[model samples]
Structure formats: C-alpha cells, structure tokens
Target chain A: MREMIKMVVVLTVLSSFSGGLLAAIRNNTKERIEYQQLKFVKGPAIRSILEGCSNDPIVDRFKIKDGDVEHSFFVGVFDGKPSTVALESFGKGFGGNIGVMVGVNVKEDTIVGVGVTTHSETPGVGSRAKTEPDFTAQFQGLPLKKEFKVKADGGQVDALSGATVTSRGVSAALTDAAGIYERVKPQLMEKLKTFAN
Target chain B: MAKTLTQEFVKGLWDEIPPFRLVLGLCPTLAVTKTVENGIGMGLATTFVLVFSNILVSALRKIIPSKVRIACFIIVIATFVTVVELLMQAFTYPLFLKLGIFIPLIVVNCIVLGRAEAFASKNSVLASTADGLGIGVGFTLALGALGGVREILGNGTFLGKTVFGPAFQPFTFMVEAPGAFVCLGLMLCLMNLVGKK
Candidate 1:
C-alpha cells in the first residue's frame, strides 16, 4: 500500500510540474504564435485569393460567433468599397483535412478567388491542387450558389489527372466554404461596416 | 566527471550516432529528409526536447519511483515537445505547416524516451546534457546530408533553388517513397563499410 501510494504521489507531482511549465510557455507565446500563423501559414492563400483588394486582408480581419466557435473573416476593400470577405473551410482529403480559403464578393454573389491553405495530399499528384494555377483559377468569379463538384461527378470543375480524390477533396472544401459564407453572410456584412469607415 | 561528460557527448557523434550507429528515431528521419530545411528543423526540435527531458529526468531521477519512471519521463518529454510545437507554429509557420503531424509525433519519438531511460536515469545532469547535445547534432547532420542528396538528384535543386541548369532532368524517383528507402539503405551500407574499415 505504501509503495503504491508513493508511486501515485510521485507521478502526480511530476505531471503537475510539467503541466504548469507548459501552461506558462503557451501563455507567453500565444499572441506571437497566432500572428506568425497569420503571416505565414494562411497569409499567402488569403493574399492570392483577395489579390486586387486595396486593404490588407490579414490586418483588416474580424471574428464572428458560429455555433459556439468563433471564426475569423478577412475583409478586403476593392474599388473603394469593403465588398469582399475571405474565410477558411476544411474537407476530408486523401490523407487528412484539406483547408481552402475562399474569397466571396457578397454584393455580387460571386467568388473573388480560391486558394489552398493547407493539405496533406500526395506530393506531385494530389499536391497539384496548390501548385496548379488552372485548378484554383477556375474558382475565381464563380457564382457562390453554384454547386461545386468534379467533372467526373457531373459538375463543371475538372479533376487533376491521376489525382481524382484530391480534386474531389478540393471541390468539397469549396462547397463547404460556400456554405459557410452563406450562413455567415448577414454577420459578415454587418462586420464589413466596421472596416468601411 | 569531466572525462565522463566528454565521453557521453562525443559518443553521440559517431559511436552511438542515431539512425546510423544506434538505428533509432527513423520516422522523422524518413519523413522530413526530403528537404534540407525540413531535416534541420525537425532535428533542432527533437534536440530541444531531448536536452530538456534529459536534464529534468536526471534532476528527478532519485525522486521518481522506479515503477513510475517511464510515465514521469513521458510527461516531461511531452511538455517540451508541445513548447516546441507552439513556438514553431508562431515563429516559423511555413515550416510548422510543412512539418505537420511530425511535430506532435515527436512526443512518441523513441530517442527522447530512450535517452531518458538509458542515460539520464543513470547519469549526472551535466553528462546527460552533453549526451543530448551530441546526439542532437549528429541527427541534424545525418538528416541534412540525406536531404541534400535527395533534393539535388530528385529536383536538381538545393533548398528549392535550381542548382543544376534548366536543361538538367531531375531524377524524380529520389523524392518519392521508394527513393527514400533506397537512399537510406545505400547510406547505411556506406556507413557499415566505413565502420568495418
């Protein structure tokens, strides 16, 4: 009994110490880490998607409550109007979740652009989703109401050669983004007012 | 004591070098060595976890019960790994994204746990730190060399820059999975030959 109690006590102390140390480090670096992620991980895709916008999408960002989760939306001003908004959505992919950033012109109900932010698809084949401009370019100026599906599934989007799964994954991600944009349109529009002035 | 510390440090470079002499921690070795940048990034992260875990384990060696030592070591090692993960995600977001899953996977890296058990548990703090430093540097060098070779042949590039002329045809196989195995096997064979001599 003594030995067992001693073992339990030792383990508890060790775990507590480790947990405390980790908590301190995490708290110290939270904001910087978040900024870094914005600058690097999601920055390029956001920039490419909202390319023509005069405002910096990363800096001109706001968050909205979405069913207990707060999701960020980047506002982009184009032609002197804060008319476009971009946000991320994820879909199941070959290896894992594929993250796609979709920019929407809420006023026109058309997409500004689409770019892949993160994916674990197979390199060279499935990875073409990120590298192939033609794939992502097709999403630009697309009607948000249009159902996104690969050509194989009787939709307009073409699948990457030899990477049908990844193509489908990307299409699904865009569909998800469209769904999100539709649901958040009212809230997003209200938030856009804050950036306008 | 000084001689023993030096021995522990020096041994990790050659006598007990990992993924070569010791034949440990092969997962990250295989996964991240496609680019020199990724290899060095992973090695340094592992080194951070390894060194800190070693020092903490050594400090608490006497206090931790024999029955629960493994659990205690894991908790310590996991804390450091999370710290690295958060720091990397904040500062090096692109590399953090590129080395995804592998960073969290470092918690289970046998090398950290193995060192905790074999050296830190039985050695002094200074010696364990030395051991961790030497092993970490050795691992970094090995990954850098492997990544360099694969990148040069597979893409005709060094760290994404074209090293070979535009006319140069890359050996695509070297960047693929089979290529990773073949390259590692050949390198291991060469190491064995040198050891024999």
Candidate 2:
C-alpha cells in the first residue's frame, strides 16, 4: 500500500512538472514558431507571387476575422503603391489539403500570380503543380471573381498531363481563394491602407 | 567495477557509441542522414534531449518509486523532447520541416530510455551528464560521417556544394531507403573491421 502511494505521488509530481515546463516553453515559442512557419513554409510562394514588389510580404502582414476563422493577408508594394495582397486557402488534393497562395491586384480584381505553398501530391505527377511554372503560369492575369477549374471540368485552365487530380486541387484552392478574397476585400483594403507610405 | 569520470565520458565516443558500437537508435541514424546538415541538426537535437533528460532523471532518481520509474522517465524525456521540438520550430524552421515527425519520435529512442534506465538511474548527476554528452557527441559524429558519405556519393555534393565537376553524374541510389540500409551495413562492416584491432 505504501509503495503504491509513493508510486502514485511520484508519477503525479513528475507529470505536473513536465506539463508546467512544456506549457512555459510553448508560451515563449508560440509567436516565434508562427513567424518561422510563415518565413519558411509560405514565404517562397508569397515572394514568387509578389515578384518585383518593393516590400517584404512576410513581415508586412495583417489578419482579418471572417466568421470563426482568422485569415492572414500578406501585402505587396509595387512602385511604392501597396496594391497587391496575397492570401492562402486550401483544397482537398490527390493526397491531402493543398495550400495555395493567390496574389490579387485589388484595383483590377485580377490575379497577379498563384503559387502552391503546401501539398501532399505525388512526386513527378501531382507534385508538378508546385514545381512546374508553366502550370501555375496559366492562372496569371485571370480575374479573381470567376470559378477556376481544369480543362477536364470544362473550364479554361489546362491541367497537367498525368496530374489531373493535383491540377484540379490547385484549381479548387484558387476557387476557394476567390471566395475568401471577395469576403475579406473590405477589411484587407483597410489593413493595406496602413502599409501605404 | 566502477568507471572513472573520464572513462564514462570517453567510452561513449567509441567503445559505446550509440549507433555504431552500442548498435542502438538506428531509426534517426538511417532516416535523417541523407544530408550532413540534417544529420548534424538531428544529432544536436537528440543530444540536447539526452543530456537534459539524463540530468533530470539522475536528480529525481531517489524520489521516483521503482514501480512507476519507466513512466517517470518517459515524462521527463518527453518534456525535453517537446522543448527541443519547440526550439527547433522557433529557430530552425527549415530543418524542423525536414526532420518533421522524427523529432517527436525521439521520445521512443532506445539510447535515451536505455541510458535513463541503465546509467543515469544508477549514476550521480555529474556522471550522467558526462555520459549523455559523450554519447550525444558520438551519435552526432557518426551521423555526420554517414551523411557525408551518402550526400557526396548520392547527390555529388557536400553540404549542398558540388564536390565533383558538373560533368559527374550523381549516384542517386545512395540517398534512397534501400541505399540507406546498404550504406549502414557497409559502415557497420567498416567499423567492425577497424575495431577488430
């Protein structure tokens, strides 16, 4: 009985100590980890989409609350005008959710660029959605208000040859991006105004 | 028989090296040793966990009851692993992405639990620390060497730099899964041959 009590007490104390330590470390690292994730995972897509823009999109960012979800928008400055905003959205892909970053020209409502940020698509096949510039290049200059779909679905976009599912995934993500852009445009414009210098 | 502090420390470098001599913790040794940078990063992360967990286990050796000692060790080790994971994510996000899942898997690493159960539990705090550091360094060196061999042969690069001229074709097989097994086998064989003296 004494051994059992001791064991229980020891395990309880150890677990509590561990929990407290982890909580403290997590609290300290939360913001930094979030920033690091942005810089590495999403930074490349944002940079590519906002190519030739004067400012760093990763640093100059803002968030807007749309219903229950909070969406982050990265602002891009061209010729000193903060006219482009990059937003991320997800779509079910060949393997899992594909994260797509869509850069839009606020005044024109046209896409400046579209890049894949994350996906679990198969290499050399579905993964080409992220790798081949030709595929993503097709989305450039297209209006953001329309629904995007691959050629197979009777849409304007041409799908990659052997990666129809991945191409469809990217198209779906862009369509989702279009909805998110329309929903958050007012708040996004308001946030971008602050970056205009 | 009692080992002196120097012996305890030095033995881990060669006589009881985790992957090569002790023949333990082969999971990360094979999985993340595709690049020198990744190998070093993983080794350092494991080292941090091993050292801290050893210290904590040694400190709490008396308080932890034998019946629940394994549970206590796990909690302690897991806390440190979480700490390492958080730190890696916060600072080394790229490496964190590369070493994804494997970092969390450190909790189950035999070298860590084996030390906690065999050495740290019986030794003084200072001695356990030395053992951890020694073993950690040994693991790091072994991994670095393995990664160097694979990266140079497989990718024709060393630490991302081209080791051979542009004309040279890389032996891509060295970086794949079957290649890992073959490389590890050859390395183990070489270690045995050298140690035979």
Candidate 3:
C-alpha cells in the first residue's frame, strides 16, 4: 500500500510539473510561432500577390472577427499609400482544399493580384494552377465584387488545360475571397488608416 | 565495472552511437536525412530533448517509484519534446515544416526512453548529461554524413550548391525511399569494415 501511494504521488507530481513547464513555454512561443507560420507557409503567396509594395505585408497585418472566425488582412503599401490588402480563402479542389491569396486595392475595389498559397492537387495537372503564371494572371485588375468561375461553367476565367477541377477550385476560392472582402471592408479601411504615412 | 566520466562521454561518440552502433532511432535517421540541413536540424532537436530529459530523469531518479518510473520518464521526455517543437516552430519554421510529424515522433524514439531507463536512471546527473551530449553529437555527425552522400548524388548538389558541372545529370534514384535503404546498408557495411580493426 505504501508502494502504491508513492507511485501515485510521484506520477502525479511529475505530470503536473510537465504540464506547468509546457504551458509556460507554449505561452512564450505562441505569438512567435504564429508569425513564423505567416512568414513561411503564407509569406511567398502574400509577397507575390502584393509585389512592388513598399511595406512588408507579413509584418503589417491585422485581424478582424467575422461572426466566430477571425480573418487576417496583410496591408500592402504601394507608391507610399497603404491602399492594398491581401487575404487568404480556401476552396475544394480535386485532391483537397486549395488556399488562394487575393490582393485587392481597397480604394478601387479591384484585384491587384492573386497567388495560390497551398494545395494538394495532382502534380503536372491540377498543380499547374500554382506553377503556371498565365492562369492566375487573369485575375489581376478584375473588380473584386464580381463572381469568379471557370470558362467551362460559363464564366470569364479560363481553366488550365487538363486541370479544370483545380482551375474551378481557384475560382471558387476567389469568389469566397470576394464575399469575405465585402464583409470586412469597413473594418479593413479603419485599420489601414493607422498605416498611413 | 565503473566507467570514468570521460569514458561515459566518449563511448557514445563511437562505441555506442545511437543509429550506427546501437542501431536505434532509425525513423528520423532514415526519413529526414535527405538533406544535410534537415539531418543536422533534426539531430540538434533530438540532442536538445535527450540532454534535457536525461538531466531531469537523473535528478528525479531518487523520488520516482519503480512501478510508475516509465510513466514518469515519458512525461519528462514529452515535456522537453514539446518545448523543442515550439522553439523550432517559433524560430525555424521552414525546418519545422520539413521535419513535420517526425519532430513529434521523437517521443517514441527508443534511444531517449532507452537512455532514461538504462543509463540516466542508474547514473548521476552529470554522467547522464555527458552521455546524452555524446550520443547526440554522434547522431548528428552520422546523419550529416548520410545526408551529404544522398544529397550530392541524388540532386548533384551539396547544401543546394552544384557540386558537379552543369553537364552532370543527377542520379535521381539516390533520393528515393529504396535508395535510402541501399545507402544505409552500404554505410553499415563500411562502418563494420572500419571497426573490424
């Protein structure tokens, strides 16, 4: 009985000590990990979409709550004015969800550029949506409020050859981005004011 | 029967190296040794966990009851692994992404638990620390050498720089799964040949 008590007491003490140590380390690293994720996972897409911008979009960011989900907006400064914002949205692809980063000029309500952030589509086929620039380039300068769809389903966007599903996925993600932009435009404008030089 | 501190430390470098000599912790050794950078990163992460866990286990050896000692060792090792994961994510996000699930899998690495059960549990804190560090460095060097061979032959590059002229075609087979097994076999054979003396 004494052995059992000692075992129980020792295990309990060890577990609690571990828990406390982990909690402390986690608290310290949470923000830095978030930033690192942004800088690596989503940074390339954001950078490409906001190309030629004066400010580092990854660093100049804000989040707004839409219903229960919080959406992050990366501010892009172009020609000394912080007028563009890049946001990420996802759509169902052939293999999995495809993440698309969309940059829009807040003042003009037009797309500055678009880039694919993440996807699990088939290589050499569906993957072209990310690798082939010609496909995503079509979205540049388009009005942000317009519906996005592949040309196959009677829309303005052209689908990648042999990759209709992935192209449609990208269009769907852009459409989702439009709705998200409309919902958060007011909050975005308010936040961008702080970055004005 | 009692080994000196220097012997405890030095033995891990060659006589008791984790992967090559002991033939333990093969998962990360096989999976992440595709690049020199990845191999080294993984080795360092494991080293950190091993050393810290060794110290903690040795320190608590007196208090932990034998019946629940395994549970206590796991808790201690797991806490340090979590700490390493968080630190890697916070600072080395790219490497973290590359290492991915393998980092978490380190908890099950027999070398860690084996040391805690076999050596740290019996030895003083200082001796355990030396053993861990020696084993960790040995693991790192072994992984780095393996990665160098694979990367150079498979990609025709060393640390991403072209080792051969542009005219050289990469031996792509050296980068695949079967190649890993073959390379490891040859390495084990070579180690045995050299150690025969």
Candidate 4:
C-alpha cells in the first residue's frame, strides 16, 4: 500500500510537470501558430477562392458568435465593396473531418468559390479534393439554395475519379456551409459592414 | 563510461538505425517519404521529440519508480511531441501541413518510447542525448534517401524541381504505397548484404 502510494505520487508529479511545460510552450507560440496556419494551411485556399480582393482576407477576418459556436468570416473587398465573405464548415470525411471554405457573394445569394481548407483524405486518391482545382471549380456560382451532392447521388457536381468518398465529404461540407450561411446571414452581413469601414 | 557513451551514439547511426537496422518507426518512414521535403520535416520533428524526451527521462530516472516508469516516460514524450507540433505549426506551417496527422502521431512513435525505455531510463543524460541525436540523423538520412528515390522515379523531379526532361516518363509506381514498401525492402536487403561483410 505504501509503495502504491509512492508510485501514484511520483506519476502525478511527473505528469503535472509535463503538462505545465507543454502549456507554457503552447501559450508562447499561440499567436505565431495562428498566423502560420492562416498564412500557409488556410491562406492559399482562401486566396484562390476569394481572388481579386483588395484587402488581405486573413487580416480582415472576424469571428461571429451563433449560440455556443464562433464562426470565422474572412472579408473580401472585391470591386471596392465588402460584399464577399468566406467561412469554414466541416463534415465527415473518408479519413476524418474535412473542412470546406465556402465563399459567398452575400448580395448575389451565390457562391463565389469553394475550397478545401483542411482534409485527411488519402493522398492521390481522396486528397484530390485539395490539389485538383477542377473538382473544386464546380462549386463556383452555385446558388445558396442549391443542394450540393455528388453526381452519383443524383446531384450536378461530378465526383473526382477514384475518390468518391472524398467527393461526398466535400459535397457534404458544402451543403453544411449553405446551411450555416443561411443561419448566420444576418450577423455575417452586419460584420461585413464593419470590414467595409 | 566515456567509451560507452560514445558507443551509445555510434550504435544508433548504423548498428541500430531505425526503419532499417531496427525496423522501428515504420509509419512515418513509409508515409512521409513520399517527398524528400516531407521526410526531412518529419525526421527533424521526431528528433526534437526524441532528444527532449530522452533528456527529461534520464534526468528523472533515479526518482521514478520502476513500476510506473512507462507512464511517466509517455507523459514526458507526449509533452515534447506537442511542443514540436505547436512550434512546427508556428514556424514551418507549410511543412507542418504537408506532414499532417503524422506530427501528432509522433506521440505514439515506437522510437521515442523505445529510447526512453531501452536507453534514457538506464543511461546518463549526456549519453541519452547523444543517442537521440545519432538516431535522429540516421532516421533523417534514411527518410531523405527514400523520398529522393520515390520523387525522382515517380514525378521525374528532385525536391519538387524538374530533374528529368519533359520526355522522361515517370515510373509512377515509386510514389505509390506498394512502391514505398518495395523501395524500403530493397534498401533493407542492400543494407543486409553490406552488413554481412
């Protein structure tokens, strides 16, 4: 019993120290990490989808609260108007969660572009969702009211060859984005007003 | 003591080199070697974890009870891996994205835990640090070679740069899963052949 207590105490102390050390490192690098993620992982897709924006989307980003969740909106001033915004929505993917960035031209009630922000899909197979522009290009100009689904499921978009599951994941993410946009349209519009000034 | 310390370092470079002589840490070895860039990133991230964990484990070896030492070692290792993950996300976001999933997966990597148990827990801190460095360099070299071969044959490029002429037909198979296994197998056979002498 005494030995058991000693073992537990030692383990606890060690774990606490480890936890504290990690927390320190995390806090120290938090800002730089957010910047890196924005610049590299999410930046390219956001830029490609929201091209021709006068302001940097990453810098002009804001978050809105809808109940417990906070949704990030990247404001794009295109043609000298902050009428476009991109937001992330997630859905089940072949390997894990797939994050899709849906760019909305709020005034037009249509998607400006769609890009895969993050995904764990198989490389060269399901990962075509990220690398292959042709797959994502189909999302452009899609009306907010349109139901997004792969052609195999009787929808318009053609799925990537040999990556049907990933295709479905992308479609599902876009569908989810449509719903999110509908729910947050009023707040999103209000936020866009701030970026314009 | 001095000779043994030197031995610990030298052994990891060849006699016990990972994914080749030891046949350990095969997950990242196979996954990240798709590109030399990814291989080097994964290798360095892993080395950072290995070195720090080994040092911490060795420093605390005398105080830790044998009964729950594994738990303690895991805690130490996990903290280091998280630190690596966070730092990489901050400083090297592109590489971080390229080696996605594999970064966090380093927590469960056998090499880190294996070193803590088989070496750091018993050895002096200096010796353990040397061991970590040697093993890390070896892992990096092996991964780099594998990635170089795959990239060259599969894409007719070296580190994403065009090496072969436009007319050169890529082998294609070299970048695929089967090719990773075959290449590693052939490399191991060659190492064995050389070792026999």
lDDT tens readout by residue for model 2, B61-136? 9888888889899999999999999999999899999999999999999999999999999999999999999999
What fnat does each of the candidate structures reach?
A: 0.95, 1.00, 1.00, 0.95
Model 1 TM-score on a 0 to 1 scale: 0.79
Residues B109-161 of candidate 3: C-alpha lDDT, one tens digit per residue: 99999999999999999999999998888889888888999999999888889
Q: How do the residues B112-192 of candidate 4 rate in per-residue lDDT, one tens digit apiece?
A: 999999989988899999999889888888999999999999989988999978999999999999999999999999999
Ranked by TM-score from best down, the candidates are 3, 2, 1, 4
DockQ of 2: 0.91
Interface RMSD, candidates in the order listed: 1.1, 0.6, 0.7, 0.8
- The root-mean-square deviation over C-alpha atoms between each candidate and the true structure, in angstroms, is 4.3, 1.9, 1.3, 4.6
Model 4 chain A, poorest ten-residue lDDT window? A139-148
Q: Which stretches of candidate 4 lie over 4 Å from their true place?
A: A30-45, A79-81, A88-190, B4-7
- The models' CA-based lDDT, in order, is 0.88, 0.92, 0.91, 0.89
**What TM-score goes with each of the models?**
0.79, 0.94, 0.97, 0.78
| lDDT per residue as tens, model 4, A16-50 | 88788888998999988887778787898899988
lDDT of 3 at B161: 91
Off by over 4 Å in 1: A31-42, A66-70, A79-81, A88-102, A106-111, A114-190, B1-4, B195-197
lDDT of 1 by residue, A1-197 (tens): 99899999998888888789888988999888877878787999999888888988888888987787778888889888998888888878898999888888889989888888999999998999999989888888889874689999999888889999888998998887777777878888888888875
Instruction: Give the 10-residue window scoring lowest on summed lDDT in candidate 1 chain B.
Output: B1-10
For residues A1-197, write the lDDT of model 3, one tens digit per residue: 99998898888888888899889999999999999999988999899888898998988999998888898999999898998999999999999999999999998899988999899999999998988999899999999886898888999999999999999999999999999999888888999999999
